[model samples]
Target: RAPEEPLHLVLPSDRRLLRIAHAVLEHPDDVRTLEEWADWAGLSPRTVTRLFRYETGSSFAQWRQQARLARALERLASGEAVASVADALGYASVSAFVAMFRRSFGLSPGRYFDTQAVIA
Candidate 1:
């Protein structure tokens, strides 16, 4: 079976949820927890988690990772080195970043352009 796609591509059905998501996007690398997001959105943590799944079809943590990955892709595409990108994105280490990137895209950041070239 094909891997399930990331849910950031899916729009949130609730306007309030969308606003919360936008706030999260403003600082995707800040390492904030769901509780923090809930406070920022003026909702309870449980409600925030439920709303994320209901409106965005992903858990809050999953959505955050997707947001961070999206930013990572942009930085990497602009010629940032993998280790530096990892640090800038608040990853514990470069290996962790590579692992997450591989899981998300099925290719390490180092090989992403190579794979694109082959596909083209």
Candidate 2:
């Protein structure tokens, strides 16, 4: 995906999967494990994992990461501080958030914003 493009989350047809997706999208900072989420959704962990991959074309972990990244992009575009965004996203540290951002977009948060500014 392009650095400027928004991440698209697929909503599954299954009610259980849909519930989990909505929760993750609504609260990307939630750091619950797949098993915990499954329990909350009244699904077995194996079912959750299998259905997430089958219905969404991504694992639960990947979906949550994308959700978090999407929110991070929105906040950063609105001129939020890196540290603030990192904290709000439940990252262990600014550097950890930066690393994830860099891995995803191949640029640090500051450089990403700078590039975005230039493009705009």
- TM-score winner among the candidates? 2
Q: What tens digits encode model 1's per-residue C-alpha lDDT throughout 25-63?
A: 776667778887678778899998898898777888888
Best-matching candidate per lDDT: 2
- Native RMSD of candidate 2 (Å): 1.9
In Å, residue 87's CA in model 1 sits off its true spot by 2.0
TM-score of each: 0.82, 0.92
Question: Could you tell me the lDDT of residue 51 within candidate 2?
Answer: 94
Q: Estimate, for each residue in 38-90, the C-alpha lDDT of model 2 and write its tens digit.
A: 99999999999999999989898888888899999999989899999999998
The deviation in Å at residue 8 for candidate 2 is 2.1
Worst 10 residues of 1 by lDDT: 1-10
Clashing pairs in 2: none
Q: Mind sharing the TM-score for model 2?
A: 0.92
